[model samples]
Target chain A: MSNLLTYISVNDGKIKRSSLEVLSRCNEIAEKNGKTSSAIVISDDCSTIVENLKSYGPSVIYTIEDPIFKNHLNTPLLKALTLAMSEINPDVMAFASTEGSKDILGALAANRNAAALADVSEFDWTGDAVTAKRPVMASKIISSVETKGSPVILTVRSGSYDTVEKSGESKVQSIPFTFDKNELKLTLKEIISATGDKVDLSEAETVIAAGRGVKDEEGRKLIDELAAVLNAGIGASRALTESGDYDPSLQIGQTGKVVSPQLYIAVGISGAIQHVAGMANSKVIVAINKDPDAPIFEIADYGLVGDLYKILPPFIDELKKIKG
Target chain B: MKFYVCIKQVPDVNAPLQIKEGELIQDANRNILNAYDASAVEEALVLKEAHGGEIEVVLIGPDKASETIRKALAMGADSGSHILTEGSEEFDSFSYAKILAEFFKDKEYQYIFCGKQSQDTDSGLTGSMLAEFLDLPYATNAVGLQLEGENLIVKRQGDTGQEMIELPAPSLVTCSNDMNDPRIPSLKGIMQSKRKPVNTIAVSDLKNGLTNGSIKTSVVGYEEKPKREPGKKYEGEPDEIAKEVAQLLDSAENVI
Candidate 1:
C-alpha cells in the first residue's frame, strides 16, 4: 500500500480547518485502500500545531520547524516541501488550496518533477494515478483530470469535504531542515491586515458579503452589525473592494477568495457569474437586492427583493433576538 | 529595468459554452487576452511609465493568438514574442513551463510576470513552475507591485492579509486581476500596435522542445456543474421579508 500525505497549513500558529478537511478526506482514502495517511507541517514551531492535528487522525505527522517559515516566503518553503517529498516518498501529496500553499505548490511539483493538480473539488486515487475533478471556465464547468505519475501533488479547494475527528496514537517526527540566508532571494516586508482579529472568510460558517449597495459608512455599519449579530465573517464583492470601500483581501469572486460557508448573505450584489463562481458552493445562500431580475436570485436559496439598507437593520435585530 | 509579461489567449469565460460528447465547445471569435494577464500587462506598463524601462509581453499559443499579443502591445508594451504552437497539441502546465523556461533560458530581464491563472483552465501553476525551472525567486497573486532601488516590492494577497514582499531583480510574479483596470486600447494605440515588433518562433524551434511525454496531466472529459436551483423569492415590505427570512433561517433552515 502506498502513502498519502496531507500538508497541514498553519497560519499565525493556528491550524487551518481546511487542512484538516483535506486530512480527513485522505484518511478515508487511506483506510479504504489499506494504506498509510500522513501529514506534514512546516512552520516555526510545530508542537502546538502537531498536538492540534492529532484529532484529525493522520498516522504520521512530519514537522519541519524553522524560523524562516514564520512568514510566507516561497524559497525556503519550497525547499522544505521538496525535502519532505524526498524523505517521505509519498504516493500522493495533498494540500489545502490556501494562498500560502498555492505560492509553493507548483514550485515544489517542479522541483520534484511530479504531476500537479490545483484547486480540485473532488479527488480519488486510482491504481497508480490520481484522478480529480476541478472547476474550469470560472466554475461554469467541471473538468475531470488525471495525473499520471508517482508522488502526485494536489491542492484541494476548501469546503469540499467534512472534517472528521478520529483520535489515534499518532507518531510525530521532526525533519531536519536548515536554511542559508544567501539562498533566500526574497524578503517579506510587512503584512497589511484590514480585517484584524475578524473571522477568516473561507473558514467561517457564515459570511456577510457586501456589494455596490453598501455604498457609504451607514451601509457598512449595517453590514457590520449584521455580521456581528450572526458572528459571521465580512466579505465584499469586487465592486465594493475595487471602489476602496473594502479591502482587496475581502473580495469574493473569480479573481479573489472562494468561499463555501454554511450560510452566505449577499447584500446588493448583482450576482455576476464571476462573483457567483466563488460562493455558489455555499450551503445556503441569501440574497438581498433591489433588482428582482438579478442573476443572484437564480441561485440564491432565499431571495429578498429590497434595499439592503432597509433590510439589514431589521434582519440584524431579528438575528440578535434569535441568538440571545 | 526590463520586464517581460507572459500572456495567454483564452476563450472568453462569459461567452456561451456547450458540452458535446464530454468536450467543451465555445465560439472561436470570443477568445480574448486572459483578464489576469491583461492586469499583468497593465502593471508592467505602469511600472515602465514610472521607471524608464522596456516592457515586452510573451505569449504561447496558436498562430491566431497573435491577436492577443497585439492587444497587449496596444496597452503600451514595447514589443511581443509569440511562441507559436500547433492548435491540437495537448499540453499541460508542466509542458508549458518547460517550453517557457527554454525560451527564457538565454534571455535577460529584471522581472517576469504572468497571470495568476488562465481564465479557461484556472490551473494557476505555470508561473511558479516556470520560476522553479529557471531558478528564480517568485511570488503569486500579487495585488500591487512597486520598484525599490533595485528590488521589486510585491503586495500579494495572502490567506489572511496583503503580504508586502520584496524580491531581487530577475524574479517572477503571478499577478491578480484585482490590481488595476486594464486600459481599453485607444484608436491611436491600436494603430501603433500594428507597427510594433513581435518575434514569432515555432515551438519546435526551441532548444529542447516539448514532447507528448512531458505532459503528465490531461483532461479526461468535461461536465456541467450541478446546478443549484433557486428556492423561494419573497417580495414584500423590507422589514417583513427580512424578519421573516431571519426567523426561517432558525426554524426551517436550522443554520442560525
Candidate 2:
C-alpha cells in the first residue's frame, strides 16, 4: 500500500526513552498518511521482546534475530532496517535519536540514498510533507524540515515529545525477516557494566541535583535525605562530580548525562549554559543558589535565595510527613 | 597503515553563539576546527605517529572548510582533499555523511577515524552511520585504541562503563576526549603547510546522487540565551539562610 508507515526500533541494554517517542510520532504521522504504523525490532528473538512493544499501537511488529543482535550493534541494525524498509516499502520510516539508533539510522539512510531528518522535537503532518523541528546551535535555533524522499527516515529527539497511550485495542503480528549477521563490521565480545548501585540520571523523572554548594558529606546527606523522602533520583553538576564529591552517574552537564525530569530541583548550582542545555526541558524547575543572580535561575520557574542545609531539613521533614 | 580522518570548521563554541533574526551569527573572523572533528584529526595523527604510515585528512563542507583542512595539514597530515558542495554549509550530518560516503566508496583506506560525535549537534551519529554505509566494523567513544596486526584492540565507553572490544581491520573508530592527546601544529609544520599538497574537487565529482534533503526543515527564528540572575548573598545566619532556602524551594525555587 502507498501509505504504510514503519517505526524502526532498537532495543539494547535498557529500552530507551526515545524509542517510545518515535512510535508515538509514527502513530500520528501514519494517521495522516492513511495507513497504520508498525514496529520493526531487530533482536535475537521476536517472542518476548516484540510482544512487549506491541502495546505501542503498531498494527504488526517485524523482527529479525541473531545472538549478535543482543548487543544492539549499530551496523547490523542498520543493515536489518535497510532490508526491512525495502521489503515493506513504507511511505514513512521513523526511529528515536538515542546513541545507537542515531548512528544506525543515519548510516542506513545514507547508504540507501534516502532522505533523513533527525533530532526532531515536534512534527506536523502537512498535505504532502511532514514538518519537523530539529534544535541546533546549542538549542538556540530550531530548524523546520519538510521531507521530500521515499520512506523519509526520521529520528526523534528523546523526551521532546510525549509518548502516546492506548486506550483502544491495537492489532499485533510478528513477521520474520532475513538478518545477515555476517555483514556487520564490528562485533561485541563482551558487555562490561557500570559499578555500584547509582541510578541513571537520564531515565529519572524527578531529580534532586546538587552543585558545589554542598561543601561536605553533611550537606550532601541533607540532599540525600530530601531525595529519599520523595523517591527522587540524585544528580550533581560538573564541578561537584569533578571535585570527586559525587558519583559520576550523578553528573549532569554538557559532558555529562542529559536528563528530562518532571521536577528538577537544583541546590547551589549556578546554571551554566552547558549545564542548563542538558536539563532545560524539565516540566518544573526549582533553583536554590545563595547568589540570587546565578544563571541556573534563568530557566527555573522558581528560585530560592538561602542556604540549602537549614532549608533542606524542614523540607524533608514535610515530605516525610506527607509520605507517612 | 593508512588513515583517513574527517574534519570540519565551525564557529568558536562560546562566542556569544546565538540565532538572531533568523541568522546564525558566527563571527566569521574567529573559527577553530570543530571540537569533535578536531579530536578525529588528532586521533588520526596519533596513529600515523605510532604506526609509521601515511595520513590523509578529508573534509566535506562549505568553501571555507578549506581553511580547516589547511590547519589540519599544518598539524602534520600527509595531505588533504576537499569535497566541495554548494550551500553544503547548511546541510545536516545526513547530507554531509552521504557526500562523504560517495567520495570514499572508491578509495580503499585501511582505517577511518572521526570524533565520537560532533559537539555542535551532539548527535554522535556520523561515524556510526558512516560505518554502516561502508559495511565496516565500527567502535565509538573509544578512550584507548591499539593496532593488533589485522585486528583492533579498542577501549570503548558505553552507558555503563568502558568495554574492551576486538574487531577486524578496515574498521571505523570514533574517539572520545579520552582517546589520546591531540598534537598542536608545530611552527615548522605550519611553515611547511603553506606548501603541502591541498587538492579540491567539486561536489559533482563525488555526486553520490546527493541533494539538499527534500525536507525543507527551516528555522522559525532564534533568540539569544537569557542571562542568569546574579547570586544574592543572604546575610542571615546559616540556620536562617537554611530555613529561607527550604522555604524558597517550595515558593521561589519550586522544588520542595
Candidate 3:
C-alpha cells in the first residue's frame, strides 16, 4: 500500500481541472513508487465528485462533506486536512498550484512540519527521497530540488500533466470532520468573476495579447478584431494596462496573471522578461513587432517582424479564412 | 494597531540572467524590491492609513536587504527591521517562514503582510506557513482589502474566479497584483528615509525552529533554459507577409 495523498477541491459542486491533473500526477508517482494512490475530496457533497475521481484510478477516496467547504474558507479546511493527513501519513502529498491549494499546502506544510515545493513542474522518486524541478527567475532558469524526508508536500503547476482516463473502482471512506465555531474565523462573502470578457485569461486555450506597441485606442481595436476573428482571449502587457488604456485584469506579466495557453500571440510587444515570465510556457508563441531586435522574438516559435498596422489587417483576413 | 510587512530584494526580472557555477545568479547592479512584496508594502500602507496603525517593514536576507526595507519606508512605512543572515546562503520557504514566525513571536502586531511569492524563487509558501507557525488565520492572493471596525475583508483572485473573505484581526495576508498601484517613493519620503533607523538582527540571535540538518529540501543544481531556435522571419509586403504567415500557421505551425 503506497502512501500518496492528493488534495482535491470542488468548486460550485464541480471538480476543477487543475485538481484532476494533480490526482493524475499523484497516480503516476504512486505507480512509480509501487504504492497505492489515494485522494481527499472536500465539498458539500461527494457522491458525484467521488464518481468522477474513481475514473482517475485512485485506490481510495476520502470524502469530507461540510457546508463550510462551499465558501472556500481556509481555516476550517486546513483544520480538517491536517487531521486527515495524520490519519494517512502519506510519504508524499501533492496539491495543485491553484490559489486554494497553494494556501492550504503552505499552511499544511507548517502544520505537519513537512517540506514543501511550490509550482513544481517535474519530479521523480529516488532511492531515499524525492527530487523536483521548478522554474525560477521568470523561467529563465530551472532549479533542481531534492527533499530528504517523507511527507514532503508539492504544489504541481497546471498544464504539467494530463488527467488520466477514468478507470478502477476505488473504495470510498467518509472522513468525519468537525469544525469548532470559534476556530472558523473567516467568512467568504462572495465570488465575483471578471465581467465583460467571458474568456478567463488563465484558462483560455488561445490568447492574443496587446502591448504598448499597439499605440492607441484605434490600434487596440485592430488587435481586438484579430482576437475576435481567431476566437481567442484578449490579454495585455503590464505597460499597456499601466498606461490606463486597458483593464488591469487583462494584464499578463510576472506580477499579473500567469497563463499557459496552447497558443500565445504577442503583438507590438518588446518581449520583456517580466512579460515573458507569465506566458513563456505556452505551447507556441508568435510575436509580431516592427522592431527586429525585440526580445520576444528570441523565444517565439514564429516571428513576424514588421509594423503590426501593416501586418494585422492581412493577418485578420487569413484567420477569417481559416475559420470559415 | 501595529502592522508588519515582509519585503525581499530580487533581481530586476527584465535584466538578462547571469549563470555561474551551475546556478542562475542575478545581476547585482539590477536588484530591486520584489514586485509582489511592493504590492504588500502598498497594502500595508493603505490599511495603516485607513485603520490608524504603525507600519514596520521586515526583511531576512543579507545586510543589503535593508535596501528593500528602505524602499518600503520611502513608500510611507513607519520603520524597518533587517534580519541579516550570514553570507548569500538562502533558506527554503518553510525554514524562512519559521524564522519570521520566531522573529514576530515576541513582537506586538495585529496583521502581517507579505507578497504572494518572491519573483526569484516563485514559491508562494511563506505567508501561509508563517501564519500556521504563528497560529494565526491567513489569506493569500489578496487583490482587495477593506477594514470594518475590528474585522477585515479580503478579496482574493482564484483560478476560476475571485473570492471575498472576511477575517478578524491577528491575521496574515499575502498580496498579489491588482491590489493597488504601489506608489513610487516621493522626494520628501526619500529624504525622511535617510534619517529613519533600521534595526538589524543576526539570524542566530532569534530562536529559529530549524536545527542542523533539519531542512528537508535543497537546490542540488540549476540549468539555464535553452534558447528557442529562431523561426522563419517573414518581411515583405503586407499582403504577401500575411499570406505567408497564414500558410505557415496552417501547414507549418498548425495553430490555425
Candidate 4:
C-alpha cells in the first residue's frame, strides 16, 4: 500500500488545529484507498505532540526531536524533513498552509524533486496522481490542478476540512536528527510578536476587522470593545494597517493573511476585492459600512448600512446581554 | 553590493475577467507589474539610494511584459533582463523556478528579491524553490528589510508574529507588498527608462532539461468560486438595526 504522510505543525508548544484538519483528511483518504496514513512532527520535543496526535487516527507517527526546531528556521527544518522523507519515502506529503510551511514548501519540493502545489482548498489522492482545487485570481476563481509523480507535496488552506477525532492507538517511530550551528545559513535574532496571547486571526472563530472608515482612536476603540464582547480576534484591512492604525500582522487581505473564521465582521471596510479575497470563505460575514452601496454588502450575510460609530455600541451591548 | 529583484507581469485582479470552457480570459491592456514584486523593486531602489548599489530587475514573461521591466527601470533600476517566454506556455512555479535557477547559475549577486507570491496565481512557491535550486540561503514573506554591513536583516511576518532573521550576503528574500510603496515613474524618468539597457534572452536558448515533458504539474481548468448570496441589508436607525442583527446572530445563526 502507498503511504500518505501529514506534517504536524507545532507552534508555541501546541499543535496547530489546521494540521489536525489536514491529518484527518489524509486519514480519511488513506482509509478509502487502502493506503497507510502517517504523521510527522518536527519540534524541540515531539513527545507531547506525538501523544496528542494519537487521537487523529494515523496508523504511524514519526517524530524528529531536536533543539534547533524550537523556533522557525528554514535551514534545519528543511534538513529534518528531507531526512524523514528518505526514511519513509511516502507517495504524498501534505502540510497545513501556514507562514512556516510556506517558507519551506517550495524548498522541500525542490529538494526531493517532487511536484508541489500550494494553498489548495481541497485535494484528493487519485491513486497515481494528486488532484487539487486551488483558489487563483485573488481567490475569485478556483483552478483545477493535477500533479503527477511520487511524493507530491501540497499545502492545504486552513479550515478547508473538518478535524475528525478518532481515538486509537498509534505506532510511534522516532527519527534520529541532528544539526550543527556552523551549518546554519541564517540566524533568527528574535520574534516581535504583536498578537501576544491574543486570538490568532486565522484560527479565531470570530474576527472583527477594521478598515479606513475607522478614522481614529475612537473608531478603533469601538472595534476593540466589540471584539472584546465577542472574544474575537481583531484584524484590519490593508488601508488601516498601512496607515499604522493596526499592526501589519493583523492585515487581512490578498497581501496579508487569509482567514476563514466562523463569524467575520467587517466594520467600515469597503470590501475591496483584495480584502474580500481573504475572508470570503467566512461562514457568516457581517459588513458595517456607512455607504449603502459598499461592495462588502454584496457578499455579507448581514449588511448593516450606517455609521460604525453608532452601530458598534449597541451591537456590543446586545451581544453582552445575550452572553449574560 | 548588487541586487537582483525578480518581477512578473500579471493581469490586474481588479479588472473584469471571464472563463470560457475552463480557460481564463483577461483584458490584455490591464496587465501590470505584480504588486508584491513592485515592493521588492522599491525596496531594492531604497537600498541602492542609501547603500550605493546597482539594482537589476529580471522578469520572465512574454514580449508584452517588456513594459513591466521598463516600469521598474523608470522607478530607478539601473538595468533589466527579460527571459522571454512564449505567452501560451502553461508553466507552474516549478518550471519558472527551474528556468530562473538556470539563468542565475553563472550570475553573481549579493541578494535576490522576489514577491512572496504572484498576484494572479498566488502559488507562492517559486522564490524558495529557486533558492533551493541555487543552494542559497533565503527568507520569504519579508515585510521589512535592512542592511547591516554584509548581513541582511529581514523582518518577516510569521504565523503568530514577526520574525527577525539575519542572513549573510548572497542570499535570497521574497518581499511582501507591505514593505514599501513602489514609486511612480515621472515623465523624465520614463523617458530615461527607454535609454536603460534591457538584455532579452529567449527561453529556448537555455539548453537545460526544461521542456514541456519536464513539467509535472498543470492547471487543467478554472471555475468560478461558489458565490455567497447576500442575505439581509439593515438600513436606518443604527441602534435598532445593530441590536436586531446581534440578536439574530445569536438566535438564528447560533454563532455567538
lDDT of 2 by residue, B104-212 (tens): 8888878888877665656565776677667777787776777778677787755544567877878888876545556788999899988988789887777554655
Ten residues in sequence with the least summed lDDT for candidate 3 chain A: A193-202
Query: What lDDT is reached at residue A282 by model 3?
Result: 87
Instruction: State which docking tier applies to candidate 4.
Output: high
Estimate every model's Cα lDDT from 0 to 1: 0.91, 0.68, 0.82, 0.92
DockQ value of candidate 3: 0.65
Best by DockQ: 4
Tens-digit lDDT track of model 4 for B169-253:
8999999999998999999999999999999999887539476545779989999998998689999898899999999999999
Chain A accuracy as TM-score for every candidate: 0.98, 0.84, 0.88, 0.98
Q: Evaluate residue B154 in candidate 1 and report its C-alpha lDDT on the 0 to 100 scale.
A: 97
| Per-residue lDDT of model 1, residues B1-256, tens digit only | 8999999999999999999999999998999999999999999999888888999999999998999999999989999999999968768999899999999999999999999999888889999999999999998999999999879999999988889999898899999999999999999999999999999998887739465557889999999999998689999898999899999999999999
lDDT of 3 at A147: 89
- For candidate 3 chain B, the 10 contiguous residues with the lowest summed lDDT are B206-215
Expressed as tens digits, the lDDT of each residue in A1-324 for candidate 4 is: 689999999878899999999999998898888898899999998888888889887989999998999999999999999999999999999999999999999999999988999999999995898999999999999999998777799999999999999867799999988799998999999999888888888888999999999999999999989899888999999998888889888999888888999999999999999999999999999999999999999999999999998899989999999999
Winner by DockQ between candidate 4 and candidate 3 = 4
User: Candidate order by lDDT, highest to lowest?
Assistant: 4, 1, 3, 2
| Between candidates 2 and 4, the lDDT winner | 4
What would the per-residue lDDT of candidate 2 be over residues A1-324, giving only the tens digit for each residue? Answer: 554454544434345566777777777767776666777766776566655676676776776666757664665666677777777776667776554554465567766666667666776554356667765555554555566656567777667777785434555444455556566556666666553355545666689999988899898998888777766878888788667687554567655566788788898898876677668777777777788678776677666666777667765775565455
> Between prediction 1 and prediction 3, which has the larger DockQ?
1
Error of 3 at B173 (Å): 1.3
